[model samples]
Target: MKLATLRRWFSPQTTMQGKIFFAFGLITFLSIVSVTGIVYVNMRDTIKHNAVTSVSDSIRQADESLNIMLEEIDRLNTVVVTSKNTVIDTIMSPNEEISYEWFQEQKRITEFLSVLINYKPYISRVAVVGLNGKVFFTGGPWMDRTVLGTPMLNYMLQNGSRHAYFKPEGAADAITVGREIRYNRETVGIVMVDLDYEFIKKTYGVKPTADSLLYVLDEQNGYVYQSESAPSSFAPSLEKVVEIKRKLAGQGDVMEQKINGRSYIVVSRLSEYTGWSTLALIPLDSLLSESTRIRNLMAEVAIIVFIIILIGSHQVSSRTTLNIRRLRSMMMQVKDGNLSFPKTEIKTKDEIGQLYRVFVSMVDELKRLMEGIRNSEKKKREAELTALQAQIRPHFLYNSLNTIKYLAKLNGVPNIEEVSGSLIELMRGLLGNSNEFLTLQEELDYVFSYVSIVKYKYMEPIQVHTQIEDESLLGCKVLKLMLQPLVENAIMHGIGPSENGGQVLIRVYAEDQDVLIEVIDNGKGMEQEQMDALLGSLDREDAASRFSSMGIRNAHERIVRMFGEPYGLSLHSEPGLYTKVEIRFPKIHHAETSAQEVV
Candidate 1:
């Protein structure tokens, strides 16, 4: 039912008021819809861009804090490895001595470690473990003595480095950074410091977030550490972790992706000191919650505005077209044979007032115009009779030509009879009918008669060659008298004035989807400039050019009028050579020629 109403409203029979309402209402509605779409797309992009930028800034701050903590760890190593205390060197010296000095060295080493614990509270333990399985320690000797690996000590000794970092084999949340104490160019013992994972997590200083997560990736081995505020529901899968790892390896610091049916923007910052990356993931939908509310509100406002516009447009159109409706009623009265009516009085200076004034003026002239038309029509008939009287001259000439042809036959003069008969045929062809399209064979017969007349008049020894490659195309239709002008031009301009009269050749053939006709003349071939001027005259449609080349121009115009511009004349010539004129038309078969003649 709605579709039927819509069809009627837009149909041609619909009232003018309905058309006005639909046109203005549709324009207003489409404008609002377009603006709404643009705002929605831009809002989405802006929200995503701001969210990514905020997350990236937070990650950068966390990475800075983590780097500071890492720097402190390195400082602790520097303090122990570069110290000038001789007691530490004596304890790590390569010598076997069971004496009082050895116990004194152990006491001195324990005091030194105690000082490091007081300096950095986050360090869980500080100890020195010797090759003989004895440990001088502080901070409660938290780690097992056997947990210290000897390979780290051997690496420091071979590379001549004092400190190295390592993660304990089974410990998940702690790392050990140790420095070797050397004496006389040989490593005697190693000093160790353990940093707990909780202290490292506290370094980032991330706050709680409802829809965001924070995690750290170890650059050395790709390990992950999550903050206390990190949501469990927002945990990344193994695949996502791999992808983040790949991102960290490159230069990209911000990324947006869909994970587990939710869009998230991930921002990362790499720490140069700790060789770890800090990542924050923010949910895009949660970030754009306010934008969604605004969009809903906009839609509601737009619907209300459209309703108001629809009601207002109807009232305005109805009021504006009231004068038009009254004018229509007056016209209906006139149609019902009422000779007079009350005058319309619209006082406002608008289009309706102008329409009233114009109608009053037009009604006053209607009776006078009717009387004048009656008198003019009577004169038109008399003029047509006068034209008929003038047409008798051509009929008299035709009769005279017939009589001459009969006399020539009676006198045994075949050439004069042939010429006279050709002239009679030419006259009949010109005056036959206005809507005549002749077949190819019929046109050729007319051209042959014209050629015979020209040959007899000029008495020139010019050879004419005609070739038809396709016999079926002989019945193809063409414009009547289109070929006769071309033959006349060839004889009058190319052959008649020439010292040695040349040949004219005509060829017709079907090629691909078109039929091509050519007329070639060898006598007095035109130069480039002359050929260009002649071709230009044929192409022009103005009166001056048409009058100058009347015969050729008329033939070209008739062919184009029948078959369109693509099927027209083209000429080619060279100095001292032959001139060729080509004509193209759609190839129509004899059986279907009548139905396709309009082409």
Candidate 2:
């Protein structure tokens, strides 16, 4: 008997309380565990993904900015080198000796180049180097022809490409951009410009930190811009640079590398403009610092939620089962022939409380019958007693059980939905050729039909009222399918989730030459920031935020596009009180759209 009682207390099939408690507890626990697990993984992955994306975007922006600067310098070279009589006349005539008149021509050419170099602040020095003799330039105090007789300048000059190549590892500390000057189909000399290397680093936009370093290298594995704060081992040797390039060609823009036994995330972008590769390196742990914090926070949250759910679900289950136990004890008392009904009120609206009320009625009817039998004489009333037993005893017991069984089964069934003809009308109205401008009255009719269908979802249906200031305003023409989305949002997001169904006011009036319409709901409102993002077209919000407000945004944009600025949709919300969305457009009526009124 003890074993049977234990089984009844725990087994879901044996008692209603056991079944309710087990199902609710299992479902709540599993839901909490599953949601916690998904959020835990997704948060970490999202942080990592965003970090990678940010690095990639910064690299591309750097590339674009560098390209613009390089192109301007190239154009500067073409303009000055190909000038009608200044640089071309001076550099092309290497045949002439270096005399007083030659110095005069060089001075005139230098003065002209100086006036142009001021336009580009990144240009350090601009010079025209002759193959045989002089170097004329205009800039700050610097070497005139330092690389004039060097083999590095000769190799770049022989390439025969009009595009300039930057030599970062040139003899001087300055990075040089040199292009061969061809005249009359023959190479005369080279036009070279020493660029501000520090300016290039300043413009790259990625700041170096203790945990990160950004540097640049030329094609020969020579330093273009090396970080002063970088570790000595961070600068790879020539062979290592070549190996890194090879692996990156096969891998991607970013890769993982080990330097001095420490892991780092290495990102490299080779600029076509300068023929230089910019590399950014951050320690692997540093890259995930934000994500690590997020992980720890999530872990703490998961523990707290688990504890709360454990305690809360247990309390709810125990409280429900306690009520069932009380009713079950009352059933046992009646079975022992004590047919007095309790005077307790059935205040709870749950299944157990309903059973308590039914049990009380059954005991009361049985007690009345027993009292009636006691007032009769026994021996003389034998046939009557037998007839009464035949009519009442077995049938009454069967009928009482049937009533109790019906009450138990009824609690499991959901409320039946009445799908009225409004749904069919709504479907028909949404069909072909309804996308043109709609009259105000025609639009109001659609709103009414839509609300009629939405009303079926609530026990106490939402109240909708239309307030038109002027009767003739119904003839105004507006964009089709405009107000419906606003109304739908007011119902679904504003009022649908509310415990007590809310009231929606669709107000239309004229302000100046424009028709002003507003859909206002007396339901749960939102914070100002959330409402701002819903109405504003910004990419910073996540996919779900954008999706929930897509329809409303589309309508708002269309209204603004048609009517120009000072128009479109605006939302005013007071959290937990109300939300109001307004639309403003010109009050124009079209004769052709009058036929759409019947729709």
Candidate 3:
């Protein structure tokens, strides 16, 4: 049903103006929609990509900066523990005595450790613990022996340098970085640096915005620092945090994750030195805000353009339809037998205007035709009367010929009776039927009648025989008078110069999908050049093969004109031998052939 409606709408039966307007409007609408959709998709992708890139770069920078501060703390702790400065190392070195030199060395190392705190602001506290029960600290004495007891400091003493998140007793959360001390093959002491929130803010310094949040995470523990400005509504759940970490672990730096039921673009960079992750989460809506705005604006612009174009298209179609409608009205009047011609008033050379001019000219021509028809009608009656007077009554002529034949027979004039009978038979064959096709048997009877008339022209009896492969083919339809001319040509041309009459044989049979007829005659044949000239001639047969090929050419062209070029006649002959003309046509039965025959 939809297909029918579509065809009806687009078919030529619809008004031309409506088609033009619909086409223009459809093209404009589709173009606008397609362009708008493409721009929206591309813009969204570009904006999202830029947002991810921006966040990824920011987090990378934050991680690099945090690594720098962590490295500084590491260098400070190493110097305090392993520095070759005799005062600091001697105090940290494992020894067997508490002598006066050791006391001086410890005092110098204490002042040296105190100087480090005043210079490095990113460090909240620094402390060194020795295996010999000697504890040295700066910024506070509370962290002196307690630093080695903490898991971070203990891990450093047992293995190597390590950093861990901690919330000490009566203190805010901080990162404790530690480096183990070793003298000879055995460990002697360790150095620790406590980084507080103020140090974190100064080192990372990545503040969160209303739409974006920043945080530092510890895979082994928990968050080291979370921005104060981070929205509580966008906080991630335990499952989401695991998902985010899992994604990061899979080697991707940026991912989109839903947090608190809102999508967020998360970007993270891990610091290799401190084993901390610097991460940023930006709301998906905020990131795509600019793209959304552009898409909406484009849609609005497209709508405005479409509206303007629609108005213009309507006006153009209206102008185009005006002339066509005028032409239509004139044609309708003509259909109703009104011959009055109107002024077209259309002057432009467009197709519609041309139609108007042609319509007006047609009306003028129609007026001339009406006048001429009236004048021709009177003459037509007069000519009809003249034709009636000149017409010969065919039945009267046939009866008159029969009467002569009977009188000549009664008078014992055999030749005259035979001539009259042949004449009547010829007349009957010519005027008996109006149809172009007849049964093969019927047509052959007419050929026999014609041969009887020509028999008198020869001294010896003319030989005419028919060979039929299938008796059923005798009932097949063949063109009336098709073989008579060929037989006449064969007898007159082939045996006219011979004292003894030659034979003319007709053969009919079916081969594959076609029926073939051959008229074979023992006659004087033409040369190769004559045959070539006769067959190759398009409009006329050559004078060389004139009498020989005329009847054959007529039959060939008739078969072609009736059944098409492929079903035509082919001729073969040899001088003083036999000349054969073959006729080929589609094998059709009598009833089928009679259904649509030429008259």
| lDDT accuracy of residue 521 in candidate 1 | 85
Clashing pairs in 2: none
Comparing candidate 2 with candidate 3, which one achieves the higher lDDT?
Answer: 3
lDDT of 3 by residue, 1-599 (tens): 98885586578786666688789999999999998888776886777787777767767776777777777887777676557574346645555357777677777777887888776776767777776667777775375455446665556665563433343433445677776666666677777777766767655555333567777766553667666665566676545665687787796887778777888877787777666777778787877767767877888899999999988887878888887777778788889988875665888688888888787888889899989999899899999998676455778889999999999999999877888898788788788667787788888888888888788888888899999999988878887777888888788877666776789999999998778899888888767776677667735635324455447777777878878867787778898887787888776666345323422
* Poorest 10 consecutive residues by lDDT, candidate 1: 541-550
* Residue 141, model 3, lDDT: 32
lDDT tens readout by residue for model 2, 71-157: 887888788767858877787665454688887887798898797778788888888776766677888546456767676577558
- The prediction achieving the highest lDDT against the true structure is 3
What is the clash tally of candidate 2? 0
Better of 1 and 2 by TM-score: 2
Per-residue alpha-carbon lDDT of candidate 1 for residues 1-599, written as tens digits (9 for 90 to 100): 98986687689888777787898799889988998889887988877787777666666776676556556866876777667574356554554446677777767777887888787767877767665556667775364456456554554444436445565443556666777766677666677777776776666555323667676766444454665555567677656866865765685887776777778777777766666667777777677778979899989999999999999878766766897887777777767866467766766566876777777677667756777899889989999998898688779988999999999999999999999998888777777545456788877888888888888656556677889998988887777777777877777766667777678888999878788889888866666656566667666555223123545577767667766867778878765667787888776545335534533
How much is 562 displaced in model 2, in angstroms? 47
| Candidate 2: stretches off by over 4 Å | 1-36, 42-45, 93-100, 168-173, 205-209, 233-235, 299-599
- lDDT score for residue 406 of model 2: 57
- Candidate 2, residue 261: how far the Cα is off, in Å: 1.6
Indicate which candidate wins on TM-score: 2
Candidates 2 and 3, the one with greater TM-score: 2
